[model samples]
Target: MRAVIFGASGLLGRSVVCAFNDMAVTGTCFSRTAGGLVTVDATSADDIERLLSRDQPDVVVNCVGERRPEVWAETPAQARGRNVEAARLIAEGACRYGVRLLHISSDYVFDGKAAPYRPDSLPNPLNAYGRWKLLAEHAVRAACPDAAILRLPVLYGSAQFAAETNLTKIARQVSAGVPMEMDDVCVRYPTHADEAAEVCRRLAGALLRGQRQGAVAHWGAEQGLTKYQMAQLIARRFSLSAGHIRAGEADAASGDRPVDCRLDCHDLPAALGPLRRWLFHTEFPPVVEPWLLPARPVSS
Candidate 1:
């Protein structure tokens, strides 16, 4: 089985690459071309078409997107280019080449007013990022009717930088003994990138076998936690004091966020057997610890 993974240098993409290690995989990146990742401008239709023709892979997984909500709110055009245009180009290429596509989407597509959302649920995105993602989904589906769409929540995994992901950023602050306020209001299901990668691999396999065509599925951690609870877990794991971390309302500066977008994930479990979720207490420490700064000296 041959596969092409776009945005292969990203958090989820890296894990997806590892998950498909047994297969012939070609990983592409836009700018961060490390670990032998091929550089390809995903927004360019010609670039996408050329790659699809050259690789001739049975499956294509798109992991590229502007995940920053503030980017969409601040610079809508740039964000739309990355999030929507890129996806459209990829989907067009996949349709032309008759290749199976699995596109990564976000849970933000739905307003937090609804607790657990299914695949068929009406998407009422509140923020620009969500709105763009929803648009991207429509574009992808229109271009490639058989494309598989997988919606995921906040992801945490091995990152080169602490700021690459929200959870690792919190871990960084906690490790530094930096006094900070975390959101106790919004509920989030932070899924590990590795777990999402596994789901991607399984779905890709199914797609190759002529299954799950035009299917929309959700994969998220069943455990619901807030930024405050996540910080506390990080503190406990590293034996660091969480005294400086206080639970409060969501940071307004971070931009508009959902209250709770817990995904039902019924389709994924039904299609792929049981959903595999990693335990936060056991799996999170190693993923975040490597990026943490050196411990500061205690003041006398």
Candidate 2:
């Protein structure tokens, strides 16, 4: 089967591309084109239509979005275009072409007050980024009712840059022995991109088999951790000194982040076999090792 993956150059998108390696896959990126990724304007209807028609893909997976909440606050219009408009156009195109769509969403749709949110839980986004994602979800559902929406938590994996993902950013800081004041207030399920990608692959397979259409699912690591805890874990795995890392309150400048957005992924495993599990200590070291800064020499 043929598949089209939008934002294929991104952290999650890259893994999604690899997950569907068995299929005829066409990957598109707005910028940062590499690995033969086609650059296309996802917001443009003509661009979406042309690519859809040309590829005639059996499934369209949209991993496109403006992930940073700060960026959304800084440039609402641009973020909206990428996060909302792009999704709507892609879903509409998928519907028009009678193709299955798998849209990636975020756990940010729910407020942190609630623990372990379900797919059917009412979304009360606290920040601009979450708000836009929720809007995008609506757009996708409206245009393509059969679209499968998979909501994921904060993701980390092999990224082009350490700063591209939150966990990698912390890993970089830990590697450098840089003093960090990490937030201990908020709880996050730090899921790896590969894990999410595998879930997407299974969901796509299910959709191809004409099952779970119009299903909204949540997939995330069961382990809940704070940024401070993540830093400690990274340091432990790398044998780096976490002495410089100290637990602190959440940064106000980081925007209105949820206290706990841990998702209830029981439904996902129930619907699609067992969910992929990874031990943070075992799985993360190799992924972040390549991007780590060299240790500085100690003064005599």
Candidate 3:
């Protein structure tokens, strides 16, 4: 099968590329980049159409979206453009070409008010980031009823975290000797990028083979943990002092975020089989402290 991945250079996109089993994996990256990879901006429908027509892929998995949790407050418009508008263009192109779309979404779509959200639950996004992601999901579904919107939770990995607040970033700050603050309250399910990519490959492959993932599909790991606990795991993984990872108001501002944002994969399980089994069967090794650590404490 032929697969064309948009944003093929990003963390999730890279993993999806790796998951393909010599499946004629064509790719599209944005301009202003030269990496021997095809350049096509997902924000432009014309660009998407041009590439889709050229590649004629059987499946189109979209991983093109920006994530600037640190700078969201200053650049709300840009954030919306990246998270929302990009989804619209891809969905439109997929409908035009009659290609199956696997639109990668996020756990951020929920307000964190509810834990273990089912696929059918109505979304109430509290933050701007969450709202934008929800916008994308809606656009994708409306554009192509056949598309699968695979929503997962906080992503963590040596590769993804390294690009977006992995141990290296944490160590750089902690080694500088500034006290690191973490929220004990905020909890999430952190899925490794490679694992998530594998899940996508499995789910998309099944769908291509005429399998159903139910009405709404979810993809994530089997368990969830708190940010405070996550930090301890990270500390262990790198031999850093968990003592330096402080808790309390000064560092625990993110406690204001809705407490339980974890997703329930029961239906996803019924549709895709046991996530734990899939995770163990794969060759990917888990880190000593593999929990998803909060990037920064939420403000009260």
TM-score for each candidate, following the candidate numbering: 0.95, 0.96, 0.85
**How far out, in Å, is residue 238 in model 3?**
3.6
Pitting candidate 1 against candidate 2, the one with the higher TM-score is 2
The candidate that wins on lDDT is 2
lDDT at position 200, candidate 1: 97
On lDDT, who's better, 1 or 3? 1
- Estimate candidate 2's alpha-carbon lDDT, on a 0 to 1 scale: 0.90
lDDT of each: 0.89, 0.90, 0.71
- Global CA lDDT computed for model 3: 0.71
Q: What is the C-alpha RMSD of each candidate to the true structure, in Å?
A: 1.6, 1.5, 5.7
Residue-level lDDT tens digits of model 3 in 1-300? 899888887777878888876699986677435555688867677888888889889888888887767657788877787788889988888889888888888787777776778887778877778888899988888888888888887665555353363433444443344567766666666677888888888778876876752246776766566665665655665566667767644323553255667787777667777655334213223532333343455489
For residues 1-300, write the lDDT of model 1, one tens digit per residue. 889999998899999999998889999998786778888999898888888889999999999999875677788898899999999999999999899999999999998888799999999887888988999999999999999999999998888788899998888888877777889988889888999999999999889989999999998998989999998888777788899988898553355677889999878778878757787678888888887778888789
Ranking by lDDT: 2, 1, 3
